[model samples]
Target: MKKLLTFSKQAVLIAVPISLVISIYVNSLVTILFLLVFLPDLIKNFKKNNFSKNRKVFFVFSAFVLVYLIGIAIDILYGTANFRKSERLLPFILFPLFLLFSDALTVFEDKKTPLKIFGIFVLCFNLFLLVNLFTQTVVEYNDNSLSNKRWKKSNIKILENSKERYALFPVSEIHIADVASRPDLLMERSFKFSRDTLITRSVYVKSNDDVWLLLRQFDGNRHEGAWFHPKTARVGFVQKNITADIQKLENGWSRISVTNRVAKKANRERLQITFVDENKQYDVKGNVEYQLYVGGTQLEIGDSPSDYMPLQHRNFLEGFDRTTILNVVEGHPTYYSLFILISVLIIILFFRSGYVQFLGLVLNLVMLVLLGSKAAILTFFILLFLVLCFNFKNRDSRLKLLYVVIPLSIIAILSFSNTLNRFNQSLSSVTEKNDVVYLSTDKRIEMWKSVIDLPLLNLVLGNGNRHGYELLESSTALTLNSHNQYLEAVLCSGFIGLILLLFFVVGIFFVDFSARNNQLLILFVVLVGFNLFFENLLNRQWGIVFVAFFLSYIYKLGEVNE
Candidate 1:
């Protein structure tokens, strides 16, 4: 019975960390499995009556879960209870409860064992994501090449593929709400054409009298085109081997004149008018009413409408979003990378092999570059500096300095090059009036402004659990929660809740810092502090799991190695 019980405990211990890593990649399955696997251990711990002897331990462990519970109670009292929102807090409750009651801390006798396993898994996951990202890029590049050729041949132009640009400018600026309101004043009365005899035009006018004639022609089958608006007289031309046919037009006023010298060969070819806006380009078909003139035919343009289509929309190999790596893992790369980085640091500190530590450091630095998190990179350097400074006495000063300086130089060069490239891209976007680079920063500012403008009551008790969506909807029509975790806590549970959370974090850091002279603990605390400023760490499942596991591990170890 004793052996079986011990085996069960060992299985649960290994399963828990494995499940946590899996949760980073999969969705809710890991969380469900985590709870189920830990259940038996929870019962065993309860039976053993192993509550932390220290009162501070109890408070620190319970603070986050208790705050959530208080928010739930407030919701019930205020008649704004939401089960979905409350469910998110389950990790906070369950993780801490499991850590406090169960033998989670005692699972691995070696302090670094769990972290080493976790590091290996995380490293593998990152490599998988990297491979997937590269594969997608290659596939998309081929697709884009084919699509681009087809589009170019048909005189259609595709703009830079960006979510913000696509959303803001569709087929034409005339389709914009402001432009549509007063079409006569805002319309670009111009017709454009490329070198290959392909012509494209758009016309919008409040009254038929306001319409103006514009003409241009495609030159040598090239993608570049030109626009011409004739002020005084209408310019007409007849092509030898071309026929013009307009498809459909609605809720607009326009006219077109197409002259075909080869009248006997009336090949019905549809007129494709490619509309070019500030950021996007697409083609539309229109019906051209033709009347025979002395030498040619006059065409009257009718209602023409088209669904704005991208000519070539595909991921590129050379210019891929760094966040593509995050998509494969289905989580923020920075957050996960930080976890791996901390794991690497733990291995270096405990393993005591210079070469192994060097390799781990290199891997972490590479991961940080791929992750492209400015905060994580900064935190890494700080941690590196601290680790070197602390260990200076143990190692030769020259060797320590060499190790620190060389890695720092390499990281600096790589990071600087990456930053420069991003900056140049951002500059080009700014010039084009595409503000994708600053979208997140602007939204965060907007959210902060909205949160600050909240009512006194809501501010005090927090608007209740999951009230962030409601607040955002009322203020900005956005359904996102407070991106800042500190703000999230305050918005959910008020000042009192925020206080409890701060106490929990501060208490843990204090205990860890005071209990030992361990550099790893100090580094962990620094990372946590930096993360808290940006992310509502406790609100996320992985975040909660990370905090709970590490806190429990550190708390349990408590000056053992130091």
Candidate 2:
């Protein structure tokens, strides 16, 4: 019986972490069976008649969970309870109930084992998402400038093959929204063409007034020199290249022949083609009777666009909104990414070899940037710097260059990817814009200010996050939670709840900082605690489960390694 009980505990220990991660991934309440992690101990807690000695453990260690319980009770009494908002406190209740009922949380305190299992699986899952991000965004044609470049092959080529052969700018970036936004929109693409290649495109032009479509040749890279050819030099690069009046273009998408007589020599030369659409403004909200269209460049060597290579309405070349990598793989990429990043960072700083640590650091940092959550990225850098400083404490003064070099290289690499650089861009813009990244720092600031400007009395117990949420929707660009978790805590439970949370966090750190595995615990707290300043992660399941599970697990092991 003793041996059987021991094996059951061991089995639950391993299975618990796996369950936590998979439960969140599958995102089904049914997967919450991971709660069995604390079941054995909870039974012990309930059977303790008076709960005598366990009471102190409950107050000292359970304050973190108590914070939420108090808030929920208050909200319930006030009749302002939001079920989703109220439920964020569930993890806190479970984790500490076990801790309170039992003398020690040792049964579940195999710290590295749970984290290692969770990290390995989460890492693989993230890598799959990363690979898919790269693959999914690259849709259209490939090398040799439209890969299978050839004559329209009107005589023999298969229909599917011919469309690819003659397509130019097949990845249509020319959106109706873009056209409505900018009337005189210019689109240009470079393609290598043999002198024998004839540049023929059929355009769909729609306008109430006469529209003059123009084409020009210039290097997209240098944005200067034209297609190199002996015959074209006679003009000294002057005319509008080629212009045509497509006033006869019917209702919307009618074919208009565009012939470029510029390229004379037959040798292969890279040439850029620019299509200039006639300027016309329309209602941006799609209320306009007529919308401008400038596409269908996917024509054969002949005059018309074929049915196979119709202009793509959506352009995959621009990438899926720059940072939907997690959106593609899962629903809660932002906070969830931070969770994974926190895991990888701990593994890098303390456990892995120097090279693997550095490699994982660089790669995951890039992934964080690509994931496009400003708070997560900021939390990453701050924690990384702290870890570096901690590790570098013993190094000689001569090694300080690493301190500067490491961070700068990361920033430099991340800077190159514009999609996720909202944090970087907000530094310069006087008026913040959400061009690529979803949220801007200024927008977050604006959201924070809404909470600050509230009456002092109302803020004391906050009208609840539902009220705060209404404030976000009314005051800002979008409806979002309090971007600051501290604020979120206060909003949900009032300052008392916030105070309880902070005190518990500080208390846990003091207790755990003495463990031989304290390096891991310290870094983990730093990651999650710091991120709370920027995001309301506790409201979400990924954050709720991960933080509660690991913190309790570590709490059980705290100082025991000593």
Candidate 3:
């Protein structure tokens, strides 16, 4: 019977790490599997003999579960928490319960073994995500290249036709031809002398095709523009150098020079020119139009430089694989990158190879930078600096210099690039531009302010679990949750609940610190605490899973070491 129980316990413990790794890449089905795997452990805990030996640790872990239960009670009493919101908070209850009861921690003689296993899974997943990103970037680049080639071909056709029509017209005498012979050639003119002048004319092309064209006049001003069909508006083109020299040849043809400015905003494939000859005005029109024809789809030339750069650089090293990874993972890269970094750090600390630790540290920094979350990157650097400072005494000179050099090099590169500028712009956009509704930081600030100004009752007991969204929507007409977990806690369960949650987290830290001076736990708390300031960590399944699993694992490791 004891053998069977031990076998079952070992099986479930091994499954947990496997499920966690699968859950990170796969869908919620894997997450369900993760939960189900803990069931046997929960059942084992129910058997009287399976209770954890560390009663204090169990109670402290259980406190987090109690805090959420109280919030649920408050929500039920106030009728504010619904099934949907209650589902999100289920992890708060479930994870703590799982940690408190599971025999997995006791199964590992050296708890760092399981941690190392989990870290290996995380690193492997990170590599998988990186591969996915590179593949997507290559595919996207090919698509863009095809699109650009089509656009260029269509543009060249229009320029060629315009040049051909202009060459046919005489410099001494210009005559307006009938539209029946060549309806596409709208205007053509030859000049006796080159003088800067602008010629403006509106020409209408009748086609449902989305066409892009290059309009070049006889002088030398050309404009690239696009034309959308089904609109009866006249598209205009300008030639900006109709000279002022008049030459009367032996024939009854005279070349007159006139300068005019072309309208920059016009989009037309052809131009209609009206030139004044003495007292007579000659009207000439060209019907040369270029149609976009690429893979049976029409192309346009309005893609802005700002839009193109990101698309081009996304496949490159600087803006690497975030979108691709996000598409697969369905969560922000910031969170996943943090997960990877934490995993790498765990390996570095516990794996016990100086060279390996240094390599992992460098990789962590690179991954964080590539992830491109300003807060995550900043938090990582700060934590790294602290780690260096705290471990300064124990480290040899080489390791110390390596730590300093790696981070400094990454920081210097980031500073020299537009990544830092964009991060600053994002910050400035939030604080300086209050009118921008799309800025997430601005919205978070507004939500925080609104929550702070809630009625005294709500302030004391919180509005209720998941009530923050409705409350924010009501107050600000914006449907958003408290992005900050600290604010979310206070908003959901009030100051009392917030205090309980904090106590649970602080309790874990102090308990672990007292049992064993595990520096990793301190770093874990720091990472999690910093993340809470920007994200509602507990509200997210990934966040909850990450925090709960690591905290429990670290605490268990501390218990074993003690």
The top-ranked prediction according to TM-score is 3
Q: Point out where model 3 deviates above 4 Å.
A: 1-55, 62-71, 88-90, 93-102, 106-109, 145-321, 396-402, 409-418, 430-433, 510-516
Residues 1-562, candidate 2, lDDT per residue (tens digit)? Answer: 8666656555655555555545564543422543454466677768767765335444645576666666556666667656665556666666656544553335445545555665566666667777776664453322222223211111111223322211243222222322233222322332334343444444443333232333332321112222111111111222344423232433333444434532422111122232223222111322222223333444334344346343222343322233345544445657666656666655564344555454455556556656666666666667767666676766644334346546764665455444333544456333544332222455566677777777777678755545556655675656667678777667666788788778655565444334335666677777778778877667677777667666666655553445
lDDT by residue for model 3 (1-562), tens: 8776666555555555455445544424444554576678678767866554555665665565655666677777877756664455555555556666665666656656667776777766666766766675555533422232212221122322221111123111112223222212222221212132233222222222322222323321243222222122222242333322223332222222222343321112223222211112122133433232111111112212121111122224432323345555456776776676577567656766666666566556555565666667767666767677667787454446446655564675465343454365466656484553444466677888888888878878776665655777898887777777777777777888788778766676565447437778778877888877878777666777677767776766665566
Residue 263, candidate 2: alpha-carbon lDDT: 45
Rank the candidate models, highest lDDT first.
3, 1, 2
Task: Show pairs that collide, candidate 2.
Answer: 195-266
Of the pair 1 and 2, which is ahead by TM-score?
1
Clashes of each: 21, 1, 19
List lDDT for all candidates, in order.
0.50, 0.50, 0.52
Tens digits of lDDT, candidate 1, 247-312: 223333223333222121111122223232211222222322111101001122223333432222
lDDT, residue 139, candidate 1 = 54
Candidate that scores best on lDDT: 3
TM-score of each: 0.62, 0.61, 0.64
